[model samples]
Target: MPKAKKSQAKPKTKKAPQKLRQQVAALPVRLSEGGQIEVLLVTSRDSRRWIIPKGWPMKGKKRHEAAAIEAEEEAGVLGTIQDKALGHYRYSKQQADGREIGCRVAVYALNVTEELADWAEKGQRQMQWVRSEIAADLVQEPELSLLLRKIGPP
Candidate 1:
């Protein structure tokens, strides 16, 4: 009897890490004065780095709606979305409990009409408005900078 031929199989592709499944939302807002496209940045709760006004999406809300809400809560700004998405980016966040989780953020452009210094109600660390180009440079994640560039300055 002849020996059976040996079988071969291809290797499977590795999946992305589950720790990379976090979702967040950001908004690109412009000042009404100089018509300059500006971004609202916030300090992390741990004071680690400066970043955009973004957070986990609330249950039962669309991504863009969550982006708008995070903008209002973190930066104390009220605005209307332009019905457009700026882009997306990914990064890592360290929670207060010492857990580091990867995060993905969806960005949107908003036409801001007001600014209030009342972020305490939402438990934000700090907020500031910077020129879009400058703001893009300030973010720690390279993907976010690229997204900002794609959105362009107002």
Candidate 2:
């Protein structure tokens, strides 16, 4: 019998790129008695690191509006959100299912009108009002630190 010929296999195909996603964040701010600017920060549910209130975009609401809502829910703040975004930062979000997905966050300034005594997630998170320089030192993300350092009028 003749020797059998070998068959060649096709190479594996490349994977498609992961879909990009975005979220809205609120940087709550207020003027102190000494006429200094202050930025509000909240702790993350998992790591307890200082961060702004942020969450997934809401349907039918403007990005700024959604950011304001996140501020209220996560940090017990009510404020006027700037119509435009202050800036943006990117990070990998860790989902409950253990998936770390890349995400870009649009940050809006929320001129704090009031601070509620109680709000959603109040017990689960800690909130603080701090100076911009101190806030810059506390946040983990460099881009976010830059944003915090620059937190001022416009």
Candidate 3:
């Protein structure tokens, strides 16, 4: 009888680039007054969910600068850095053509100083200031939720 032939193993293939790996900046603004803390929340344009202001980094702006810019554009609010950083979170955003993109967002704590009546990029589904604990619960992303808990009530 002929000897059995040895089997050969195939090499692993490289993964394709995921659609969602874009760099973005986000600010978590918590407003405090008279011992009460509130968080700013913005409803996304698609009206599918609520989230904080965030966007892609601009040509020359640093991440924090981009975060401030996004806040102004999305929520009509001007803010200053309050603490080092709340933390980071990852989520998926859907594109126009229905493609799901993975996103990693770095979040910083900001103290809001002003709220402009007009926004550069209008059409946010909604905007509101909710209590910190409620705001944390309202957000759907797990990582963001965890960050909020870590920051704790302000």
Per-candidate total of colliding backbone pairs: 0, 0, 2
Q: Is candidate 2 or candidate 3 better by lDDT?
A: 2
TM-score of every model? 0.76, 0.87, 0.82
Candidate 1 Cα misplacement greater than 4 A, ranges: 1-16, 121-124
Q: Weakest 10 consecutive residues, lDDT, candidate 1?
A: 117-126
- Residue range 1-154, candidate 1, lDDT tens digits: 9999878777788986666664656665775377767777777667647777777778998777887787777677777865456777888777789977887777777667777756544564756778777877887899988776666544
Tell me the whole-model lDDT of each prediction, alpha carbons only: 0.72, 0.90, 0.74
Instruction: lDDT for model 2, please.
Output: 0.90
Better of 1 and 2 by lDDT: 2
TM-score of 2: 0.87
Residue 58, candidate 2: how far off, in angstroms?
0.5
Model 2, span 1-154: residue lDDT tens: 9989888789889888677699999999998888888899899999898899999999999999999999999989997899899999988888899999988999999999899999988899988888888989999988999988877752
